[model samples]
Target chain A: MSFELMLFDNFLIEKQAVSEVLLCNKITEDYSLALSEEQALELVETRSDSLKNYGRIEFGSGIIEKVILTFADTPYISQYRYAEFLNELVEIFYYFKNETLDLISDDDLIGTMKKYFDGVCQGSLDQLKFRELERMAKNVRLGLDPDYNDLYDSEKLREAEDDDE
Target chain B: MNSVKKTTKIDVDKLSGEFYFQSLLQEAYVKGVLSPKESERVQLECLKLLADCTERFTRGKSSSVRVEIAQGIMASNLYTIGIHLKSLPDVEAALFQIENESIEKLYEYGLQVLKRKIKVASYFYNRVCKTKLKTPNQAYNITIDQGFKPFFDHYEINFHAHEIPSDIDYQLIHPVTDLAGVEFVIKYLENLYYENLFCSYFDADIIDEVMTGYDPSYQNLLDNICEQVFLNALGCQLLNAPLHPLDFSLADLDALDRQLKKYSQAELQRQLKTAAQELITNLLLTNPSLKKYLIASLPKITTTIYRGLTTHSLNKVFVPRNNPNIKPIRHYNMGIKMDDAAYREMVTEFLSCRFFEDKLAIIKEQIKTLADMEDLLIAAELKAAEAAMIFDLLEDIELAVLTKRHPLHPAIDAIDYSASEVQMQQNLNAYMRALPRDRLAKILGMTTTIEVV
Candidate 1:
């Protein structure tokens, strides 16, 4: 029997305007952070933002939480979405971390790629409920998983997530 | 001078009505609108635009000058457009109709007038005339300096030298005022559009209140400039015509003025955007350039190009009275007589000002950058080598060569004429006819108004 793979534990909502689509918030004030089940469904219907590569909404040194893009409903066993997302993240990573001026050996390039690749492995989101992300937070630069490379930590991404319960 | 000798009398009516200032508006200005080259091109365009626009002001088929007719035509044309614009469709279309009809109806015929040795003052441009006291080259420098000064000077006299360059035909054109009013009003319209756009998506009342709180001058400036452009294109000037007072201002402005100002800022801005739109809407409704400019992408590059050379970029503030963002017009003239110290002070201020310095620097940088690009383009001797050259070019800081030969390098040029007594009198006659008697009267009455106000 196979267990479902969870991409990341949390999908942090960045801005209010876009958050409405994911039922990120239910209350209709100037800002609402949590959406009711009905509101979330309504939001999902209204908005069509998918968390491809977790998106690079805000840029330049300033984001606290590293949001991840995971399946909103039931996580399926034996799927490769994490790989797809990682590929995009790696491209961004290669652009920014890139040290060698087209001269570094292939071995060194492979090592560099692997270093970031492993950092993106969150193991399983279910177990991260009470775990502190200090190690990853300190290690990863600009909201990117240590494995991913590229510009600016996200500023205000408005992507929503799976049920918190 | 060579240009003056070459200058032959021609009928304004015979000249095609389609192109205003065509003789002066060289190829550079016709396409890019306002660019770095415009410094010199403006001299040409203004001549072309004014000549085409005010053809009716000409009294004879071929006279040296007719100051009086030019004056009357400017006033009459101004009133017609300022009062009767809008229903005419667009500014360009209006300009077309007025360019043909109003000018044709008013002026019985046409004449390429000339003035010899008579004092020529360009009140419309900045206060940058260095009158005939020096050589052609030196006079050109002084006249170029006049482009930097505002036209609104208490003193309007600056003498450069006696001779003129061969490129320009007119004996001596007055210091054409910088036309900052045009730039200023365009900015006002843009602001109104931005605010109105924001409000439409946000809150209506808040926008209204904010607009209400704005300085009355903004509305006045907007109306006046639009009205002025319309009128001028119609071949007229609004020296004393009344403007409609709007809801924003308690002061009595003319009725027509009020309606134009009150029109939705964004819609109007979106509509009258193209310089061609401006020309076509006012002069030719079907001009293709009209649609091109109006529908062009955001961050209007033309506005960016000739934006008020003054004003801080990036760091902006919101203010009503002393708003530095406002386009500074050519308004300062020291007086007719300036001693050594005053002239030096004027030059110093112009150089030190942020706008002029910034513009000068930017233009210089653009020139240098273009040279670097040219080097890379030529390095195409080998594909891989060229790519390497491009990368190398980007890295090399000093390699930037100033391609000194920009289209507008010799920015200002003039041609002075040896006036015969006959030509001199003809010029004197035009001045006597169109002399700004109203301005003189107002100036005389100003001392009393100062105390009363």
Candidate 2:
């Protein structure tokens, strides 16, 4: 077999393992929406298509696991949106990885994404992806956040203001 | 020196209109040319004329431009005063009559006029001073002032015996009495064909085409002494030699000329032939199996000829602060002419050799080992060559790993090990690949790798 076919087979196996774990997580245990073999393959295909759209390729690295772990504890995350959100988050992670000059660590970027998604974005994936993360990327490019330490600080403060109101 | 007091604060704009009229009146009274009352009346009339000119020049202009125009008017008035006193019997007395404040105001304006005249004189002198003249009996005939005497003395000590040919016009050359003068001479001679010929040949036009053109094998030898002079000057700058123009003594040029004379065209050709034969022998020894390919490719080997110095060399040659023109020598590439098909065939043969595959394997192994290391800082500390090998390997690995192709056994094993490890490997690979090739080469050449911790 060609090396790419072998690698793709390995990738499919790894994706199956990750999908089984994600579907059986404690937060989604109450929901009876388990992904079938075909559904899992579709999820993998969606991931490959999203990655290609961003001009990126994965080497079976678990960016999906990290995104799941980051958003797993959110109160609004439901079984229906879980798989699709993970797919879009994977694409956004790789796209912004290049956009932020690759200076922000993966953990820091995940933390920034969770802060925007849970706080200012208030569980709206569209707002987090299009509005907050885009602005943060621009700030990073213009050297406003050299270390990215304050990437989500203002959003956190605004969340506090909204809670008080 | 008495034209302006060192401490005077002269504002160019403030020295216009009323201020200029007051200064003129003060000068008239001090010189006893007019009584105090008469001077005051004359100053009032002058102020009217000054105001009229200012209004005319500043029309439709902004405030800042108006101020600039007013300053120009004041300057014109000063120029008129200068012309009036140019041939005055007591010019020094009239100049001394101006108050310290007025003198300070006019200092820059007056100095500019003097500078322009000096520039004209220098231009003419540089052009006409090349006529042949009898050499001075004494080395110290140029009476440089006491402050400049030490620099001139050092020049004499270094280049006393080195003189240009007596047949060349002295008027064409600047007398190299100081460092700046030496630089001027070098700059002038750079464009002159005669000086270039002198650099290569002991006598001008000695090589005749009629005598040397009969033999098809004959090659002409050009003097490269001037290039050597530039190199040595660059070396001197790198060493931080205190004197300007990075002095090249006459004796050094003469010695270089003699060395060039020793290598005849025929002898140089013979040496080149011997060098080529030795190179082929060495190449065959290194790769015995590729003997046929080497033999075929040897005659067609075309190396790029670098025409000029690098940026670093140019920087050293013309230290920016001292030589602001900063004309970096132009660099160009020249290669041996070969048919495209033949060149492509040669390249294919060379790339397909077992030597390239062996090298690629070694580099790949080194990269995989470095990628496996837990601490990136330890990998960073590898020798420059090892680091360069790792860098190239990482680029190839990244391309393969990303595309899911060229699956090296070890790399595939590493991919199966853990995600974070793979991520770390990818990050390091990208970082190293992003670095400049020259930088990677330098790092690899070093004994120890750079410390990242």
Candidate 3:
């Protein structure tokens, strides 16, 4: 039962991950969003740092390529700060994966992020992270629909109450 | 013909049992048998297996897990692999399989072994239940009854193969150690089955009497009952007497003392072991495993006998039976009680009395039966000294009946008695402890054999 001595170093995984991330560029290129090799490696490094910070261990190819392809066509992202945007998005995705208690799948969580970024978040990563995604994670934890919002429900109730008054 | 003998560089005997996989890898690496590249490949494959397990754990909905969950899956995978490796004929074969096969394949093989081990564990558990001793010992009863239910119901072999899920509390003469999970349970049940089989030779009621003779409150003790029965049986064999009663009389003790005083400690152990072997044969025990189990307990039994001999307390080692069959020589019937109306009035007045002397005066005047006196003793909040004086009014037989009926258990049984009862018990116990040795022995001896109507 002892795993105390086994190192979880990602030195070998990072090279493979970097190539996978660069392969996503061929798809993102159609959307005018492309990452250089350096940018791809940085994104992989960002995934590693986020995993460590969040006390998580990812196996296999991870969700980096998935995140890149999923977020490629979003109007919020562009080539100017595409690498930086992906890095922050990767970190936020991992942080919320834990916040959601792993009940939400990788695909579902990434799709929800893309929906909020283009919709109410209006391309604001901070809004998506701090506000929309936080609410969604809370809903998932509470066994409610992932899109359930008490704020919106209360607002509607208050408007109806005022109409009756 | 040329043949190369592939010997393992690692000494299989020195590896840890609980951490078999880790220790085996460690010894292999230290001996330079497993190169750095091979070790890395194993670690990576182990991680890959963990990742695959995590996916199955989460139903492939998540790509990441908390580090603890991952580590648990990793350890379970390694334990599974270790089980398979251990099933090999020798350490060399184990090492060869580890070097040549994929960890996933080894883990699959381990799962197969684990599946078969579960059946083996089930067989042992059934044997243990069938041969379980009938006793009033709570730990022994409950452990046999309910301890392994959780293990059979919810043993998580996929992720927690190294964790024992049972709550076994009874102590065995030879405790199960250096094993985990199902292996630990199997060894424990196997030993218990043997102990039960040994104890089954004597009558259950006689065993209880012998335990009561050992300690009037031996039911609460965690000591193994079988060892005592075996020791007493061995004592009977040494005395050339019948082993059914499993009791030693005072004359038997004197006889044993004179007989064994001649042997030195080593000679005493050798004699006891030989007697144990003879005792086994007398009982017609042909099972080699049972014979071996009895012989294995000789060291502990020998130490006990040796200590008893040196201290001149062989009576304590080979205890006499408190034969419930013995008729009491004297019986004192508690007379009829006063009517409830007068008893109620007296208790109210006694509770109203401010001084201890007044309450004692009321008790001496109104109490007609031991039953009413016993009731008032509890209802009244008398101090220890007051209770002791009240206890002095009863005869030895009356006191013995009260003592037997309301035996003062130690703090271990504190939770069962009420505060008022505990106060009365402590007072009664202190009074009995202050009595002369013969008087106390006579009272206690009567308590065991006396019948109350």
Best by DockQ: 3
Error of 1 at A18 (Å): 41
TM-score of chain A of 2: 0.68
In candidate 2, position B67 carries an lDDT of 29
TM-score of each: 0.14, 0.27, 0.74
Candidate 1 docking class: incorrect
lDDT tens digits, residue span B1-453, model 1 = 555332223332332222222311222233333254443333333233334443322222211122333333333332222223222443444334433443333222111111111122333222223121121233233433443233223221111111121121111211122211222222222322222222222232322222333333433222111222222221111112211211221222233233234434454344334332334443334535323423442233223212311232201111111223433232221123334464455435434546534533433343244333332233222233322323333321121111111111122312232223223223223332343676434433332222210
Tens digits of per-residue lDDT for model 2 on B1-453?
559533322332333222232453444556564566555444443344345444444341211112233444544554444423332334344444443224333433444443443354345334323421121212111211132233234422111211111122222222233212222333333323232332222111221211122221222322222232223333233233432233433343344334333544545334334443454353233434223332332222211001112112222222222121333232221223345565455434434546545545533443233323223323234334543454454433232332232122355847474544454445445554677797645444331322221
* Deviating ranges (above 4 Å) for candidate 3: A1-9, B1-8, B35-37, B215-221, B254-265, B307-316, B322-453
Cα lDDT, all candidates: 0.28, 0.41, 0.86
Q: lDDT by residue for model 2 over A54-145, one digit each (tens)?
A: 54434324355566666777766776866777667767876776677555666778888988888888988889888888888888889786
Question: Candidate 2 chain B — worst ten consecutive residues by lDDT sum?
Answer: B302-311
Per-residue lDDT of model 3, residues B1-453, tens digit only: 899776668987988777788889989988998998898888888877887788898898888888888888887888888887888888888888889999889999999988898898899899988988878888898888999999999988898987888989899988888888777888899899999998888889999998887877777888888988988898999999999989787789999999998888889889988898889888998779889988998888888998999999998899888755665355556667789898899999999988878988898888888888888888786788888888888899899988987897786557897788888888888899999999999999989867666
Off by over 4 Å in 2: A1-27, A30-36, A146-165, B1-453
